[model samples]
Target: MRLFPQSLRWRLSAVIAVVSVLVAVALSLLVRTEFSRMQLADARRVQDERIQLVVRDYGLSGDATLGAELDSTSIPAELRAAVKGGKRATYLERDATGAWIWAAAETNGKVLSLKTSYADRDRALDRLDEVLTIGSAGVLVLGSLLGIVLGSRLSRRLRKAASAARKVAEGDQETRVGATIGTRPRDETTELAQAVDAMAAALRARLIAEQRVTADIAHELRTPVTGLVTAAELLPPSRPAELVRDRVGVLRRLVEDILEVARLDTAAERADPVELELGEFVRRVASMNPDAEVRVTGEQQARTDPRRLERVLTNLLINAERHGAPPVEVEVDGLTVRVRDHGPGFPDELLREGPSRFRTASSDRGGGHGLGLTIASAQARVLDADLRLANAPDGGALVTLELPDRP
Candidate 1:
């Protein structure tokens, strides 16, 4: 289905080969033209000299002999016409016999003509053509080979830069393309690599500044939020007092979520792996939440950080419960767990751009601070698990968590 190669290296090589072939053909034509002109000129010179010698011999002996023809009709028409006009002319002509270099001249009342075989010149041109064909082919092959080498080198450098960009996109801010450094001239590939590294450095600095600000704000608010919660606790056991306490509690939880997100963003928390039965773990975690429906399909065990895993699952459950309709289902199969809620599925933006902090799923679903899935994703990273968020085919938000098999 493809007419040409999809690789940069092959395209480059093809371009080079085409150009080389054109150049080779142009040069070959020029060389053949010049050589033919020179050979023809030489043949004319030899023919003129021989004609003069024949004329002299005829004048001295008064006899037409010795490779000379008297008014020969074998002479070319153009050359014969020139001789008839009382002038000498030389012409190259080819016939069944072979190529000939003809010279004719008028003397007194008679026309003298002489011709020599041009097979030598023809043979020389043939050899030259052969050489040119071989040389042009060699040029084409050499150009393609050189193009492939250069293209491969450039392709490799670009791939390195692309790989580094992928890593940076995947939340590895430290990943960089390590471009070549030397006195040699920097090419486009090197420039691209350098640009990737620069972009990553800038991004890392920006993210660090954002995380530091978030962490600082959370740290500053923790004390005031704690004091507010304590004051609300002392107020009284009335509706207004309970409302105050509830608001303070929400504030406290928000602050804690912010702090946790900050820590996860900076990768300050490391996983502590512990061998545990995955099915039992899912049942226990789901049991804590009365609304969730747990179904352990198979008994599977894994070596993973149970604490981090619990955090991720808890966020998913809570997010589903709060933002989705009732009948939240949790299924454990092998090393994977699936959590689904019967409600309008995740928002298009959330599914497209992954989870973002402070960006609620939707107004339709009871919205919160919107850090649940973000925290869950970060915790999944720490646990070295794969967390996928999707809208179930039937309906509702579906989240699949697959733990790494390191048993």
Candidate 2:
């Protein structure tokens, strides 16, 4: 059995219902007990008055005993014993017919009993029961409804904060929750939302400052890097000169990757969506990378930024060739593209932590600025696509890209 509701609204309503039930039961018992006590006191008073009347009658008639008049009354056994002993006694009890009987006897052998069927009292009790039953039902309905409304109101605020946090985590550093979830009444959840908004704002400022610094450094180094390349080309043909050129090229590529990452971080690259045959475009990208054997299957056409798609595919192919074995499979079915390589698959950190700039999936197997997959991922987001990395069960690395809104 499902013991609790996953939704907060139902849980709150359940709590209200339990409390209402307990309170209603307690109230009903207290009212019934008090009413019974009052009724019993009234019944005993009736019997006392009757006993007095019997004593008066016997004294006025000058009779020696009042047994004849007492025999017709419903005096209790205890009260009769007291009368025989020349003393007064009283008793209250219920009889076999469910009626309450109260009796009193006097010293002069006079006795009287009062029988109350408890009809009026019982009828009042029944009416009270009816009122309690109806009132309890009404309380339950209203309490649960109020709880649901309150829970929903609370849930909405939490959801708004949670949604904005997710957007921030997904690289939209500009997202903030404070505007929507204001700190009214200053509750704990409201305080938490304010904290989240502050954190997002701080992170956004830090990232913007970092990206600007990187872009500026890249721009500054371009002149020196170009000079080094010219000087290396002018050197005489030799092993050391070739090494100089090779190292310079690597430095140049690193600078370019850094600049590209900075641009992607700042949303500097805008997408130009165009209608293209996705299968053919991927096939062409595969042709550019001869290191991996590319196989294309299934045709699909979509409207998307072709240049960004090309960049994502090229990085995926390069990564597969550098870190994985041969036989890369590129398949496009509908709007989904799959790129698989025969290799040890993606590292655990890459799978769990996602792609990070300057953090290669495998340091020993490949060499780069470690921005290849990071760039691919950023471009995918820019194109409003999804790029996922995983290992094939058959022992290979798999990269899948999903595009939407087909033409």
Candidate 3:
């Protein structure tokens, strides 16, 4: 038979109960056996004492007439026969000359025979065995019942936890297994519940973030798409050159935005890193946009992918020109670069979102996708830099790019 139970709660309870029962049964059997042995010994001692008394009384009377005084009712017939039998007890009659003699003694004209007390002892032992058997049965029943009750309670608690976990798995973020104040769960179960709750919370947050990113992407893509459609419809060979240039510039900027987004996604795996000077680099990028006042503030150098870094700075300056009032300031510290635009700063809601693909704070702006800042932030990550967006207390948005001082 299998010794261990299958279920955890039953297994534990069975082990405890079985061990308890075995100890109790063993002790009971030992006590019962000892009692039975003592009883048998007492019976034998009484038999011996009576035999000696009867013999002494018969000898003093000079006759076998002491039989009438012997209480035969006190001893069973089997015991009397065994004590009187030649193999066990010797009976003798002596003449005046002390010569040995034998005489047949009868009780009421019946011959006495040797008796054995083994049968009585056997009966006593059988009674003891019966009592022990009944006690063991009771103990076993009681132990099993206790095991069942304890196991049932534990199983119920586990089932409740499992049910709550299932609800969480099925997308119920609020599902929780309430801590049992009456009987606290063990460490393993408590840890499992905690881990499940954490996972549910994380999953919910990720889903929400993804949904926001999707919405922002759609909003950003709409402006460029509408402009492209309008420009295509109004294409005219007779249009003024300035008008044509303006329309073409709009189309080129839109394409650049699209390409920059794609590059940010692939840069980490595709781009190669190179060494460059921060001071000269910022000056060169700023020169590209003369309309903006870009200044290098610190003398730190870095080893980075030049092409990607240039793209990042260029996009930032472009974003400033499109959204800010005037004189966009670019300052470089040891490993940090700060770009401040003199414009109405970032929207309060957009600051919490950090940055994501195609997300911009210019939904209210005339007609432009909010992709420039998003693209810049993604490129910063590919270069292993941190980009933070905050509003200047005075009045403007400050974009900080903190890079590592690389060799």
Q: Number of the top candidate by lDDT?
A: 1
Poorest 10 consecutive residues of model 3 by lDDT?
97-106
Between the candidate structures 1 and 2, which one is better when assessed by TM-score? 1
Model 1 weakest lDDT span, ten residues long: 176-185
Error of 1 at 164 (Å): 2.1
Q: Could you give candidate 3's per-residue lDDT for residues 1-407 as a string of tens digits?
A: 88756786787578767876897789887988798668656655554454455454555763333243333453334444644433223233223534221222234333332223355555667787888888887887788778778787777767877888787664455567654312364656677667766777887778666655654664577677677656765766555755765776776666666655654443333446776788788888988767667566678768788887888899888877787767788888767888888888787776886655545565532234677777777777778788899989998888898886542
Q: Rate the local accuracy (lDDT) of all candidates.
A: 0.87, 0.78, 0.65
Name the lDDT of candidate 2.
Answer: 0.78
> Tens-digit lDDT track for model 2 on 21-69?
7888788788878877887677667666665666666668744233324
Which candidate would rank higher by TM-score, 2 or 3? 2
Q: Which runs in model 1 stand beyond 4 Å of their true positions?
A: 179-185
User: Backbone collision count in every prediction?
Assistant: 0, 0, 7
As a whole number from 0 to 100, the lDDT of residue 173 in candidate 2 is: 54
Instruction: Flag regions of model 3 displaced more than 4 Å.
Output: 1-245, 266-268, 356-367
Task: Count clashing residue pairs in model 3.
Answer: 7
The residue pairs that clash in candidate 2, if any, are: none
Residue 366 error for model 1, in Å?
Answer: 3.5
TM-scores of the models, in the order given: 0.95, 0.88, 0.43
